[model samples]
Target: MPKSKITETLLNSTVSKYRNLLKFCYFLMVFVVISCGNDTKSKVSADTNENATTETETEAPATTSSKTILFYGDSITAGYGLDDTNDAFPGIIQFKIDSLDLNYEVVNSGLSGETSAGGKSRIDWILNQDIDIFVLELGANDGLRGLPITETKANLQAIIDAVKAKSPSTKIVLAGMQLPPNMGQAYTTQFKAVFSDLASENKIAFIPFILKDVGGVKELNQSDGIHPTVEGHRIVANTVWEVLGPVLNSEL
Candidate 1:
């Protein structure tokens, strides 16, 4: 064989090997770029998933359901002697709830001068209700009649228990009352403590004194002094609304 022909063959072989190595290197560089791109895309996808979950969690709190409340009380709650339906606390509360767009209603279960025994007797009628919240407002009549404090406490406690047993999910708010000074401090204290104790023992909610800062005010009281006037009802509604508003999550 000619030397020149042999040298030419060798050079051709080396060139072919070098070309193949160059192509392999080019393929590796492209593979690395594709791998880095995929890694970046995966990280972006994971970040997007985390952001979506966080957004859903943040929105959950705004979608909670609002609660309903029932107004259960006596003449004072009944808007006794107020000649108009809107003059009652139920009416007032209804208006407030409406303004705030709360899913609630105020069931006015008021009776005039009803004693605790009467309340006990009529309890089933009251208990047989689909109430989410109960404003336990009784015992004023019992206090007026000089009824036994123990009796009043028992009746109120029974009502509270019944509400819990029946509804189980219903929240109780004891609208507390205080006796007139003429009743004497000892009896007054006992009468007042009836509600306080019942509410405390049951681990339920309470309104320190429903008529606080408004009960005996002449302008706020009705002609009877015991009952509230139209203006008085407004005050009472606001008083009851103050505690009840937060419990029911009702606006205004």
Candidate 2:
């Protein structure tokens, strides 16, 4: 072959070899870059976990039980239509507190069909004496009977403010109740919010929705589908005691 032809062929072979070498180097660089990215991501995750651990460690300590609580309100609170000892949440709560050997008395002040207006009327008579804590479980009947949320809220506010005024040291807990779904969404939403709003304003503990687990279940409620059965009451007791047992300091 001629010298020029031979040189051209040699140049073509060298260019092909150089292209292959360039591709191999590029792939190695890409692999190293991916490895570095994974390491950086792992470090960030570790740092986030470390910060979370430190935040939890710096959180405040929990407070122990402080005082006795009196259960006050309407029919459900009063144990309406339930047998003397059977299916009564108040009775069940009393048993548990005694069993736990806690220094809190479960005082039953439930009045059947009692409205917020009625509670206001008898607040002076029913509780002329002092109390360490008050569990307000009203507004169920108000919502059930389709009473105005405004009136219910006002009555509840009055009762809480009265207790605060008379017994400034008392810790109050507001037990929430949900109005029936049939009562339109607007009304139900407002009614449900009343307890939380007041509790927030007063800096009190709230049960959110007391009848949550008790309501709707066929076995839990009685024939009326309104009152909870004895077993249901036990569950209710557990619910209230969950909140009540922690704050009580001594027997009432």
The number of the candidate with the highest lDDT is: 2
Q: Highest TM-score among the candidates is held by which one?
A: 1
- TM-score for each prediction? 0.70, 0.70
lDDT of 2 by residue, 1-252 (tens): 999999999999999999999999999999999999999999999999999999888885776663456889787877776767434787787777678776666678888898887788788765676688899998888888889899999999989888888888888888988876898999999999998998899899888888879888889988998888877777887888777766664334
Screening candidate 1 with a backbone cut-off below 3 angstroms (N, C-alpha, C), the clashing residue pairs are none
Model 2 local distance difference test score: 0.83
- How big is the positional error of residue 212 in model 1, measured in Å on the Cα after superposition? 1.5
1-252 per-residue lDDT for model 1 (tens digits): 899999999999999999999999999999999999999999999999999999989887666554557677788877888889678877988988889777776777887777667766777887776778888788898888788888888888778777888888878888888988898889999888887788889987788888877888988887888887877777888888788878775333
Question: Where does candidate 2 have its weakest 10-residue lDDT segment?
Answer: 243-252
Residue 55 lDDT in model 2?
88
What local lDDT does model 2 show for residue 135?
92
